[model samples]
Structures are given as C-alpha cells and as structure tokens.
Target: MNLKIDIDKVQYDASKRSLAKVQLNSLWGKLALNRENYDEYAIVESNEELWGYLYDKSFEVKDLFCGTKKALVRYKTVKEYNSKISRGVNVVIAA
Candidate 1:
C-alpha cells in the first residue's frame, strides 16, 4: 500500500489553539485500517526506530498523543494526529 502525508492548508494558530478543516482521503483510510489492525500486526512505540519497520512492511506505529487507537492508525504525523483529534476523530498512540 502507498501512504502519503498531507498537511492541512489552513495553519493552526498556536496561541488560539484553533485548527483548520481537513479532508481525509483513501490513503488515509488505508492507514487507518493499518492502525486499527495493530493488534494483529504487532504495533510498537519508538517513532525513529519504527520507520524502518514501516518501510519494510514488517510493523507500524501510530502516535496519536491523547487520541484513541483507531485514529492513530490513519494519521502518520503529530500534526495529522492533532488535526484528526480536533475534528472529533479519536486518535491514540499504539504499538
């Protein structure tokens, strides 16, 4: 599967803690599935180390900060994680 990371066009105002609207795509959906299947796939922590495994298709990790397990799978970055959470999507870090 192909994965792409796209940032929302609208910048989040750190001071205000407001976020811009975002649209989720198919690739993102696939990522979500991957995240949800962490239990079956054996997800892990350690972002730096996980990259190699993710690239090799051996393992995966979702950094959702305070998100639910489902949201973390689709989101690949901290920003994406936060954006999904802001939109009411539940994202959580999982291994």
Candidate 2:
C-alpha cells in the first residue's frame, strides 16, 4: 500500500522530511493502537451514575477522581464479561 504525506515543494528539505516521517509514524501508531491498554472515562454528575459504575460487574473501575459538580470514572471492561473482540480492532487491518 502506498502511503504518502504531502510536504512542501522543496528538494532535500530536512524539516519537511522530518515532518513527513513524524506524520507517517503517528498514523501507524494510531492504526496499531492497543485497545487493552486504553482506558474508558466518564463524567458522572449524579450519585446514581457514580454508584452504577462502582457496582458494575462488567467493568473494572481503575480510578475515581471526584469533583464538586461531576466525577470522572476511569475504567475498563472486565475480560470475563467482555470476551468478544472490539469493533474498532481488526487483526487483518492492523496487519
């Protein structure tokens, strides 16, 4: 597959080449993202929502940062509860 990043119309430009390389690397990094290492966050504004995540069996709560108006819950799905493959991840596409 041909992947190209358009750079400034200059011959042997170090800056332009560096920028293009960075762009390409970032693209690859995003495409090969590890969903298992990614954490899902939610801003809970109600007591009900906060308690829901705390008691949720489908998710493993990692951290809880509480604020006055809203709270942030950082969590990930329980492996046992979510054994299915993620929709955003595809081994063929990543390959």
lDDT of 1 by residue, 1-95 (tens): 89675686666586554332222444345334444323433344556434554464433444433223322232232233333323322334211
Model 2 lDDT per residue over 1-95, tens place:
99786676536979999999998777666677768877999999999999999998987899999999999999997786447766666556545
lDDT of candidates 1 onward, in order: 0.39, 0.83
Where model 1 places Cα greater than 4 Å from the true spot, the runs are 1-39, 57-95
Q: How do the predictions measure up, each by TM-score?
A: 0.18, 0.63
Task: State how far residue 16 of model 2 sits from its true place (Å).
Answer: 3.7
Cα RMSDs, all models: 19.2, 5.7
Model 2 lDDT-worst window of ten? 86-95
Q: How many residue pairs clash per model?
A: 7, 0
